[model samples]
Target: MSLAADLGIAFGRVAFVMLFVLNMGGLLTWVERKQSAIMQDRIGANRASILGLRLFGLFHPLADAIKMLTKEDFRPARADRVLFGLAPFVSVFFALTAFASIPFGDTLRVGGREIPLQAVTLNVGVLYVFAMLSLGVYGVMMAGWSSGNNFALLGGQRAAALMITAEVAIGASIMGVIMVYGSLNMMDIVRGQGALLWGWLPAWGIVTQPLAFVLFLTAGIAATKRIPFDMPEGESEIIGYFVEYSGMKFGMFAMADFLETVVIAGMTTSLFLGGWQVPYLDAAGVRLPWGWTWALPHLLVVLLQVGAFVLKVCAVIFFMMLIRWTLPRFRYDQAMRLGWLGLFPLSIANIVLTGLVLLLWGGRP
Candidate 1:
């Protein structure tokens, strides 16, 4: 492609990722409220409305934006002003940028041109995501340390410890995936998943590497600082890292959390759920392993693939929200034990076992 075309593609991908992540984040806020309300037998977020049409609390996010925006921007008088102000932006920026390497669909061919559906096809996309996630910790640490509050500093310490611990399992689990797929490229992994196992089952990561999937999902939730592992922002007791923050700064932190959830969901879908892969469907038509074939329009095929990817992401997000609402928070000691003693070893063993099986079977990469 020409330089101009490359630039245009880059811009388009960036715009698409931003809008997708933000929209998912907004929708998840509503999902959290509605799901919790349903689980607790209560009405949820139904008061926000426009023109007397509530749309089942669909307007709540907008109302929240207005409320937060209109609130006073508060900061502690003795706090580190620069770091406190910079913290939430750091959180939000990393959350947004981390989704760039995850592929939402396989590819699209329009007219005479073929375009990949991901933002950027980095050779080490998996590593890139890990790097971004690791860097995200700085935001929380800064928020807590800059606040000059003992409680906030404690929360920051917990966050750093939890992330560092969980990341070991997360990295190990993904290493299994990299070994199975035999590539660090996200697109290649997604394409590899398009194959069929035993001429019937779709060769998704969940099927081939179920243990890694579980470990990765668990560690991913911990990395995002969600339920069962949310000691960092234990709002009920321990003051959170952003406890002293208010107004849009606090909103930014909230937004970053939701966006991080979406990113995790997307990554889970892409890595384990056969991203953009509709069974028996390809760019041209449906082709089954049993010698069956059916032609489909190119546009229809593209729609099917994209729809499958989106549906998988939404399903994973729903499951994650359910987990957040249903699971009890882990004690700090228990969380640490699970991360270091439980998940880490399992992830490592999973890698070794996967390698042995692949070696014995001489599996094709």
Candidate 2:
């Protein structure tokens, strides 16, 4: 409608997405502890509470926030003050912005005006998200180099190397999905997935590009720089890129990691797990393969799509956490080998195979 209304809608969408991303990032700190506890057969983070309200350590994140806020903001005496101060913000900013292009649901029609559920709609959303994620490396490098610490510099070098190895594989891995969807738009890709194959199976990326799914997920985990790929922050060795950071600055770096995890999960859900698409469910309602149709209200349909997307993202997050507990950290050399000699070539092969299959089939299968 009017320019003001359009701006208002855009602002609203941005607000909603930011709140969701930040809150999830915070909650994931709790999830990580609790999930790890259950897996290791121990109680975790249950001590933080207020007025006899434990809430199963739900208050830990809140307690963490307060502690970080009140802690002394420290900087190394030899550090470059400007870049050292700016790095954490850069990391958090890019991580949060990357989620802007992710579509949480389909269009929401209200008062005869259609509003997209995503914060931003881009013709090249995949590239946009990837670029944002790649930019985060600068923050890591900045944090390490500006800290004026030898250990931090070494950590930065490792981080850069790991990022390079993983990013190449990640870029190559998504090529097959692009070929299958035949569009760079994230919404287009998700919409393409809603179609049924053989009038029975949903045409999700996992079905069409199963190899890409596995490769992307593997590379995505490496990109997040978590356990088994966390040589950049080898705490066991008492070193890291942000080793000199303290207080909220350090918190920002930690938050950035969790935010990246959420972004990776969102990307996996969007690219391979059908995004907001529900089985047999369209904008109007559910139309089963066996001639059964259930018409749902527009609001309900939107809610269902959004809910499905949320659930899928959560499931992916849970799986990632499970992997975190299950696997031991890989040695740097082994991690690099897996990314370069293993995932990279496999991703390239997957692309070629996808191309051949599409050529023979004449379209998505």
Candidate 3:
């Protein structure tokens, strides 16, 4: 391909990914409010509407965007101006970029050209995601330290601690899946999972590595800093690392959190839920094992794969939101203990068991 062609493709993929992430982040604000309201038995975000059309509080996120844009961007009296300004951007940037390596679908063949459905297909896709997740902590630390407030600093310290504890478990938990798949590439892992088990069950990551699924989900939730693990931003206790931020600056921090949630959902879908892989649906169409066959057009097949992946990600995101409302916030000590003393050790044991199972089987999981 020519340089210009490559550049255009890169730009197109980047724009597509960013738009999806940003829209999902905005939508999740409404999801959070409505979800919590449903759980609490109260009306939520119904006041905002467009020309008398409420649309089930969908316009509330639009109203919020307008408000944030018009609101004054405030700073602390003694804050480090540069780092304070950069912190939220860093958080948002890493959160959005982390999804680049995740494969949303198998591939699209158009006019003799095969287009991979991911923004960037890195050989070390899992490691790249892990790196981005790790860097997200620097944003929290910077925001807290630069805010020139003791509470903000404490929140930053808490965030740092949470990341350290949770990441170890996250890494260990995913290690078993990586070993089972025998590849670090996200697409490779998904393709491997597309195979059938006993010519009937879809050999998904969840089926082959159930323990990793549980461990990864646990660690992933802690990494997001949501309810039951939100020590860093315990709204009732402290204003959090971005306590001094206001307007869109603060909005960026909030958006980062939501975007991170989406990333987690996508990762969980790709790693555990059969990403874009419909049961019995292949490049041609549905092929049953009982001598039955139904062929589908290539376009329809691609769409089905893409739709399946999106649906799975959305389901994961909804589950995460449900968890947010259902669970109570954990105390600092409790959260730490759960991470280090519980998840970490369990993840290690899971890896050992996985290794043993793989050794005995000596075949693809």
Candidate 4:
């Protein structure tokens, strides 16, 4: 194929990922509420109706989208109109863009076409994700500052500081997996896990880098600012950067949170769970009969991988929510102290241990 054609195909993959994630966000809305309800031992949000028929809050996400659309658009009288408008776009854009470097499946066969499941295979895919995540603080900071609300400014500042602390730990924790897998491309790291261990355990990031897994999970929760670490937008106190925002404007930030949930899940899949690589399936189960024939199994693998990825992410989200409902929210000082002093030291220790493990296993066949 021509170079232009190749580039087109790659961009098409990124578009496909965006569309796929949006649909997942729809389903995830239902799953998260339903699961959260179960965990809390109460029925949560199950009463939207279509001609007097209710579907267990399943239709509520649609209900939500419509409600957000119909709500009155509000802007603070003194708010910077342009920046107020731009903040949500900034949030949603980064939420959507970060997935480009990650693959959803192994490979597929179509009509004489062999398509790799990842959108763009860069050598620094994981590092690239971390960098994008760091930049996301701007969205919050801009929204809060532009709103001219003291509370919003405080919230945004808090979120920015927390993001910086969390990212260092998040990056440090994942470095262990990168060292073990020996690649930054999402697919390569996953494929590396296809190796067997005593016919029982697959060489997953969790099994090898257990310490990093904990650290990554911790940093991830803090980074996303779920309860216990949510000094940024303590929903109960309503100190979020969007304090001055309402209607569709505030909805945008909520949408970003939902989408970032997807991103974090994807990252979890890529870093620790072996991504789209299902365990024990040989590359033989998927054969590229024709150059284009790779599309079918490619689709299947992508579906399964994406499915597994979503599940892992949901599990984490559920756990996070459980903590939210089960545990009391941390005081802002405690939250900051935990992120900087606690996670920083623990992350450094994890890196050293991962290095020692690599040296010990370097001689393995």
Off by over 4 Å in 1: 1-6
> What's the CA RMSD for each of the models?
1.4, 1.0, 1.3, 4.4
Q: After superposition, how far is residue 96 of candidate 2 from its true place, in Å?
A: 0.7
Off by over 4 Å in 4: 1-12, 286-303, 363-365
| 251-351: candidate 3 lDDT, tens digit per residue | 89889889989998988998889888998888989998786999999999988998999899999999988888888998899989999999999999988
Which candidate's lDDT is highest? 2
lDDT of 3: 0.89
* Residue pairs with backbone atoms closer than 3 Å in model 2 (clashes): none
What are the lDDT figures for the candidates, one per model? 0.89, 0.93, 0.89, 0.78
Model 2 local distance difference test score: 0.93
Give model 1's TM-score versus the native structure. Answer: 0.97
Worst 10 contiguous positions by lDDT, candidate 1? 106-115
Tens digits of per-residue lDDT for model 2, 1-365: 58889889999999999999999999999999999999989998999879998999999999999999999999989999999999999999999999999999999999889898999999999999999989999999999899999999999889988988888999999999999999888999999999999999999999989999999999999988898799999767748999999999999999999999999999999999999999999998999999899999999999999999999999999999998889999999999999999999999999899889888889774
Worst 10 residues of 2 by lDDT: 231-240
Candidate 1 clashing pairs, residues 3+ apart or interchain: none
Cα RMSD (Å) between model 2 and the true structure?
1.0
Angstrom error at residue 102, model 4: 1.8
lDDT of 1 by residue, 1-365 (tens): 58888788779877887898899898888889999999999998899989999999999999989999999999898899899999999999999899989988877777666878888879998888888888899999999999989888999999989989988888999988899999999999999998888888888999999999999999999988989788999867767788999998999998998888888888899889998899888777999888899999888888888789889989998998889888999999999999999999999899899999999999844
The residue-level lDDT of candidate 4 at 246 comes to: 80
